[model samples]
Target: MTAYIALAVVVVIVIWAVAIYNRLRTYKNQVENAFAQIDVQLKRRHDLIPNLVEVARGYMQHEAQTLEAVIRARSTAVSAADEARQSPGQAQAMGALMVAEQALVGQMGRLMALAEAYPTLKADARMQQLSEEITSTENRIGFARQAYNDQVLDFNNEASQFPDLIVARLAGFAHMEMLQSTQNEQERAIPQVKF
Candidate 1:
């Protein structure tokens, strides 16, 4: 009777551990899939940027500095994105990517503002089309980032739970960093409207 009871207890423990391990594995895979979706959108956004610059270059001959800044920012962002793709959940890589992307966005905004100053560039058909594409791509990237962060939250919750934490640690499942807003404090500040 003692031996039978001990065997049943061992079997139950094994089954419980296996279930936790499988759940953690599923969560990890979902996080990776979510990151992949973000990667695809980022790639699309990056690809459109050079064409945007080229179209603006013809009319904005005086804004060489702004155009160069955009190109440099884009290059940095591309490299950071490649690093993040290799290790999506890594804190350092994600941090670098966020910084680079923020710089790129700021530069792009400056370029667009300069474009608005030159009516000829603003009215060009190709310029208008590329701007529309970039805006669309930006929206897609936002959706993808939200989905990635949601998956990261779910994975972190599961992995950090008491009993599951044991399995997560044993199986080498680490917590993932969520993609946060790239906006700086100044950008996030609400504008004061004066009458």
Candidate 2:
């Protein structure tokens, strides 16, 4: 009787541990999958940038500095993204990548504003298509990033809770940091013109 009772308790503990481990694994994979979605959108955005720059170069001869800034920002962002890809779970790399992405967005905004001053550029069919594509890519990236952060939050909550935290530590499951945007709400808001 005693042996049977001990065996049942051990089996229950083993099953419980396995369940916790599997849950942690699912959350980790979810975070990675979310990041992959973001990566695809970012790649599409990066590819469109050079084409936009090339199209703008012809019409915006006097705006060399703005064009150069956009190019530099794009290059930095691409490099940071590559680093983040190599270590998707590393907090520092993810944080740096987010900062680079925001900087790239800001530079792209500047380039677009400059484009508004060029009537011929705005009228170009190719430029319009590329601009539309970039805007679509940006929206997808935003959605993907939100999903990634949500997954990170879920994983973090699991890892921080008492019994699960014990299991997480035993299973070597480190808490994941959410991929945060460098932009604030005010920065993202459009300025209203009363005039």
- On TM-score, the leading prediction is 1
| Candidate 2: residue 179 Cα off by (Å) | 2.5
Query: For this target, which candidate reaches the highest lDDT against the unseen true structure?
Result: 1
Model 1 TM: 0.93
> Model 1, range 90-136, lDDT digits (tens) per residue?
88989999999999999999999999999999999999999999889
Please give, for residues 1-195, the per-residue lDDT of candidate 2 as tens digits.
Answer: 999999999999999999999999999898888888888998999999999999999999999999999999999999998998886767888988988988998989889999999899999999999999998987788889899899889988988898999999988888777777656677769999996
Of candidate 2, the 10-residue stretch with the lowest lDDT total is: 175-184
Clashes of 2: 0
Clashes of each: 0, 0
Predictions: Cα RMSD each: 1.6, 2.3
TM-score of each prediction: 0.93, 0.89
Each model's C-alpha lDDT? 0.92, 0.89
Q: Candidate 2 — which pairs collide?
A: none
